[model samples]
Target chain A: MQILIIAAIICLALSFFADRGKTIAGIKRGGVMLLRILPALLLVVFLVSIFIYLVPEKVITGYLGSNSGAMGIVAAALIGSVSLIPGFVAFPLAGILISKGVSYTVVAVFITSLMMVGTLTLPLEIKYFGRKAAIMRNVLSFFGAIIIGLLMGVFF
Target chain B: MWKILDNFFLLLRETIFFLPLMFLLIGLFDVWVPREKIERHIGYGSGLAGMFWVILLAVAQPGPLYGAFPVAYILYTKGASVRNIFIYLGAFSCMAIPMYAFEIGFLGVKFWFLRLIFSLLVFVSIGFIMERFVGEDFRVREGR
Candidate 1:
């Protein structure tokens, strides 16, 4: 926490030096941007948290738990692709799944895909990188995530 | 209606807690970090140096993948190397300085180290593969 504070302070100081008279205005502008986006980001987080709290592990495990086989992998990947959970929440969720007897492979797939592939963000990616590159990257990442899961299965 | 109201309040709370700091960081980057400097470091046709520059950019960047990934895609189409693509993805995943700070705080130093190592390995490997096989044509139809 202290380190975070320090890092922020350093960034602020650097900005001051780098921008001269603009630093203060820049920060104020940033604050305004935050004000605009914070509501949406927070709302999403809260909804996800609610889902985490309210949904039983068994329910999720039943659908994509390790024992579900190929279907499980597909289910896990799909879930991961859609869900935009933060890393902070993702780790604990993985722990919960493990405790609930979800397969480590499925969990690995889920987490890997969650971090790498973003179905929800596809349009933005396409707009930014072009359709071909965006699609290719996501497809490759999807496969790569599965490969990682398989490797985890073999090793762990 | 009640559930919706409650959700709204919850989201408000989270935003109030986290967004201020994030916005400040973004603001700082916008104000201080010159576009020319970033371009020189990671711009089109920059090659390996550009890749390093992007990694540095990612290290300093804040926010979720939803926003970052698209920007990366744009950069790639605009002429960033596959290596730089890898660096962008890798840095975005685990190396953002703020993210690193958070990871250290929550998961400890060892976890952060492992994550950094793993992320770099994965990204570099992907980059090498893309460069070797995909070449420059990896992007969608050129000339928009």
Candidate 2:
């Protein structure tokens, strides 16, 4: 995060040297956008933290680990879509699931949906891309995850 | 309560730290990149090549998924096609290069390779599907 901030500052400084007025204008524009999205950002972080707290990892693994049919894939996809686990944790959990005999399809759907769909981030997404586009993207990605999972089941 | 608050503050701090830099960079993108260039590369007529460009752009970007939203917004204003924007979002969410390296480490090279191929196929189709639903007139709501 510090690296990103430093890099951004350096780029901004370079831009300032190239054209001062445009650089100022860019900063002002960014400031407006930051203020606009602040409420949604705060709300989402709060809600996600609460959700993560309420649902322990064991419960999530229990749900995904137990089921094994078509229902299992759906369950895994749903959990993945809603859960806030980071990639580091999610991939390891997925590895454990595979070792536990979960079908490739279920694990595939779980990881794909976790990465592609963001139920909690919808508020922030809507704030930027509008209600329609944001919702459509998630809906599409959900189905996409399923399709990808099914194909993986066929291949592996 | 304390746990939730602690988690909340941690997530909030992460966002607060990273998002401004995202916005600042996006603002610079909006200012420096000409609309016509964006149009030519990922606009209405950019075709299949546009998808390729967006996937590469998405891979190059390094950040949490939320950071991609504002960049997508700027791309839209600069006249990137709806399909291309959706593709960008899908790729940004799933196909990031750094994330791919981690995925390969945990899931094995075969799993990572197959998932990427499948994800690319599905997301390209999703992008096309969303273009139909979202269409050209979709605009970010003005008043919060």
Best by lDDT: 2
Query: Which residue segments of model 1 deviate by more than 4 Å?
Result: A10-20, A57-76, A83-112, A120-136, A146-156, B1-19, B42-50, B57-113, B136-139, B142-144
TM-score of chain A of each: 0.63, 0.58
Poorest 10 consecutive residues by lDDT, candidate 2 chain A: A59-68
Q: Give the per-residue lDDT digits (tens) of candidate 2, residues B46-98.
A: 57776777777776544567777877877777767888888888888788664
Model 1 agreement with the true structure over A29-111: per-residue lDDT tens digits:
77786577545555565665576467766776787676688888887888888888766456445544655677767877787
DockQ score of each predicted structure, in the order shown:
0.33, 0.37
For candidate 2, give the docking quality class from DockQ. acceptable
Alpha-carbon deviation at A75 in model 2, angstroms: 0.9
DockQ of 1: 0.33
TM-score of every candidate: 0.61, 0.63
lDDT of each residue in A7-103, candidate 2, tens digit only: 6879899999999999989888877866876776676667767866897756554655544467788988899899776564466456645655667
